[model samples]
Target: MSLYGKGFMIWQLARCENGNGVEVARVARAAGLSHVLIKIADGPYTYNVDRTTRVDLVPPVVQELKKNRIQAWGWHYVYGSNPVGEAQIAAQRVNELGLDGYVIDAEVEYKQPGREQAAKAFMAELRKRIPNTPVALCSYRFPVLHPQLPWKAFLDYCDYNMPQVYWQAAHNPADQLRRCVNEFKNLAPYRPIMPTGPVYSAGGWVPTESEMVEFLDAVREHNLSSVNFFAWDYGRKGLIALWNKIAAYPHPIGPQPADIPEQYFSLLNANKPAAIANLYTDDAVHITASKTVQGKEAIQTWHKNFLTNSFPNATFEITSVSGTGSTRSFTWKGVSPSRGKIENGNDTIGLIDGKIAYHYKYFKIT
Candidate 1:
């Protein structure tokens, strides 16, 4: 059974530039996404216009999206201190654009003094006109709930509260999700929660598919109505992989793999390393390993090295595997000939020819 509704973050993607209904539809269909929240702009009051001359895209991508049966939402980039004059324009645009709902991305600092009143007024007026169309509010931390903050007032006006519970550079993601569920459960009972996770960042590190799966598992565990990614590019592969997986499951949510210490690690070892190397069916990946191996030769040599060095002599037990379908991870722990006894360490492995294709290890010296 489908999740009934699936959601994704749009804007700034190469696909967005294409602006063709067919391309958009193909991606949505492939990812099992039914709803797309198009990000119109970047930060505090910076609208993503086609050239600042035309704020909306030509021919309205929303119509194309809806044609493919994808519900579309308009995200207004706003800050606490921005002028109300622009707010009216934004409200008018939402109605004209025929968007299903509005996402108020609060990128400004609201805790500072003398900022709450303006923010409240803006949200109230916007809500007053678009009463039927749901409003999704975005905020960063618990600070958005401060007495000095207008989040409460905004919440009263909006339909749902979408807290950006992204743990990219903050605390560990697992810990962060658990804490967020507890906090939201107590504070926003009436509001349906849609937590946004970090799929990508400017830091250039893209999350693997399995890490994305873990995030989705968190969303399901918390019983959130839906989950959204931060931006278009970051860890986008993982986000799409997650959507495909959810589309397969009978229930959209599942149990978090907390009790199982090696649940993630074990999958790594079970992977067909040979097949992993040839994941990109269309293009060939240029791989260079530390042991002067490339392509198929590199993959086989690495696994062989591992078996010769660690297995039999030591307990070569797989610890966890974190990543999506083809692009997965393999973590193993035991005594090795290179060192003495080991606890938790990982060797990045890839597949080739239905077996292990590539394997390399990273080290963090203490």
Candidate 2:
């Protein structure tokens, strides 16, 4: 029941105008979701966007979700009519009702000039009206929008970036999710990324429960903070079924395997450093050859020194490696990097990244 990183949003599927808005909130909460995104309904079947609606319907939904321990927010979708007005209205509603935040879904012209400035101005006006409300933006992926897109221009006025990464379901969704999160982080390393993942595709390919769990597992694997599903409803039966299946997953994917090579010899033969430093905390320490290295720098220096001294001209060949969370172990046979085939027995234990945390020379000469 610890809902820290999981989030769900209702876009057009459940409208406030309809009597089912309250029930929709119940369903979202029952499914172990911590966030409920209510897409403001301006279309038919929803009550008019007015102060009365805010007082009667909107705030009640927010409170209802809160009662079930779910953080509620308003996501205003903007298109041809210009989103600034709806953004203002939603922000006012959230502010009056004391909700968590607001999301501005902008469908912008990716090829237009001065579009960044226009987006910034819209965000600035929305912020001015909302004052203290946390603002977020939904935009296309970096590759689609160009690497030099005005992310900063919009991010400066907003709090988070929700890039829509609706890639096909492949072998490892987590790796893809990590890559996407990293790309956004590379754009603005300080800001958080809320990637939008699709549960079901338009072609009717619904990801299996294991696959959906794998997607979330991939998110956790990369230490990503949060995620958003592509949509609320589109008459897709598989999506609801998939959500139910994901809810049925015994546990949210816990700590995932570390992204490191299995053996030291493989890394060395591949021209890779025996140890990398940044993958650990600043104060991380390791015991190598019965000698405790205080920090990453010390560990790196020690690892390089030992390998060079023990096997002056040896090459490494990885045997096997596997681990989850922070603990990992690997074994390798050393050979001459230049020579085709000489073997040396020097086993190495790596931590986190490919850093040699502990090393022992099994045989002095082979």
Candidate 3:
């Protein structure tokens, strides 16, 4: 739900609507925003908190956004200096805010000499605390340009990739976005790309309304799920015309239920058993040709064993899907490195409040 349609990123919530939660939500709804991302933490400290007043600025906005049927995602700028501390603060903000999703904003500092271990540490800790919540890695658009950013480390846990495709001085947004997508598609532990376009002015370089449209057009041309505008405060104040243009864009703004199976397949490909298990209800049941398993912990163990031992380094692909109401039927195939392959796989799932309550699988190795 967080990665569907148009999204707006609010760098400083207090700067917008004079810190009025209701007004901020009203603006998001007026602009037809599907999701609003707010900065929750910076480094190892909680952001958007009044240092002197001792007030948390996010809960009200998050609450109001939900009332408006909009997703509220929290973003944090992480420095590799204290990965564990950062992870602790991020997870704390997420749970306390009741966010729909979380984004890890790892940038220049992450490209240091040795942040791979730090990246691994941060993600491991964060996932343990909020395994089921959808996580995204927000970073530079072109992965080739920034090889040292530990793309695999953070992406292994991320459900989406929100690239900062900010065409600051250049007008070639379409080409840059295309290049960004191509570079990311080749990365392992792949996550769906959701681009972030530039909406603010910088150093006398302001993106034209046409450029914003082209950026969004490129998002659709590349079959991306959604597009986000950076610094909502700047966009609303300085680029009202561009903001209006984005609001009028014809992209259908909402999540599709049919995407559930593909999302599950993505997690399978990411090789995260904890995440896969979290997608199910606590009392969920999964049945296979060999045996049946119930409870989330059992499901996690089953997948951990199956994915790690039986089908280590396997790629799962959905062949087809058909469903009605709460029930879905799908076919998938998995090819493993040393264990050969599983084919003709068919499965049925029953969703309860967006979490899988029942799953039945049938497959054969050939």
Best by lDDT: 3
Clashes of each: 27, 6, 0
lDDT of 3 by residue, 89-136 (tens): 999999988999999999999999889999999999999999999999
**For each candidate, C-alpha RMSD in Å?**
18.8, 13.0, 10.5
Which candidate, 1 or 3, would have the higher TM-score against the true structure?
3
User: Model 2: what TM-score?
Assistant: 0.60
Error of 3 at 158 (Å): 0.7
Show pairs that collide, candidate 3: none
Flag regions of model 3 displaced more than 4 Å: 255-366
Candidate 3 lDDT at 220 equals: 78
Best by TM-score: 3
Each model's TM-score?
A: 0.59, 0.60, 0.74
Supply the TM-score for candidate 1.
0.59
Q: In model 2, which runs have C-alpha deviations exceeding 4 angstroms?
A: 1-3, 13-22, 41-57, 80-87, 143-149, 168-172, 234-238, 250-366
Pitting candidate 2 against candidate 3, the one with the higher lDDT is 3
lDDT of 2 by residue, 20-75 (tens): 55665677666666676666544112222345444345666777777776787777
2 versus 3: better TM-score goes to = 3
